[model samples]
Target: GGRGGLAALRDTWQPGPGPLAEAQAILADAGLPGRPKVWRNRLTQGNLQLRYGRDARWYRFTRSGTEWRMDGPPSASPVDLAY
Candidate 1:
């Protein structure tokens, strides 16, 4: 329902080591290696998407065609949702 959310965030999103970068680093530290396409607080690699919540947690999402659906519960560590 909120496909444009990321785009809307672009104006306020800064280019630096924030949640997106932290999540990437977490995955790498956990030995799950792969760089995802990032935009603001969201990252996408293949059909999997990782979104950072305002609550300082990470949420996993899976894509089906053009829609992205939440796959499971949120985690404080991105590594927990790396799978």
Candidate 2:
């Protein structure tokens, strides 16, 4: 899943801005703010995670078909995450 798949979303992870609006929308619908202090990729295909707000917790995001979803409320960012 690293060759392409959702990994391509990193194209917006540059110094300026990122294309997380759509991804954020998913979080918004779940009552989670659409902002992140840090964004990182997961070795799992079509999966991503972020840390936001006052909590240093990490929330997992998964892609199903063409849509992205929140794995649940923010949990601690695991030490094993790829990035």
Best by lDDT: 1
Q: Can you write out model 2's per-residue Cα lDDT over 1-21, one digit (the tens) per residue?
A: 222323333332332123233
What TM-score against the true fold does each predicted structure earn?
0.68, 0.32
- Cα error, residue 51 of model 1, in Å, equals 0.3
What ranges in model 2 sit over 4 Å off?
A: 1-45, 48-54, 79-83
Residue pairs in candidate 2 whose N, alpha carbon or C atoms collide under 3 angstroms: none
Determine which window of 10 residues in candidate 2 has minimal summed lDDT: 11-20
On a 0 to 100 scale, what is the lDDT of residue 1 in model 1?
Answer: 13
Error of 2 at 44 (Å): 7.5
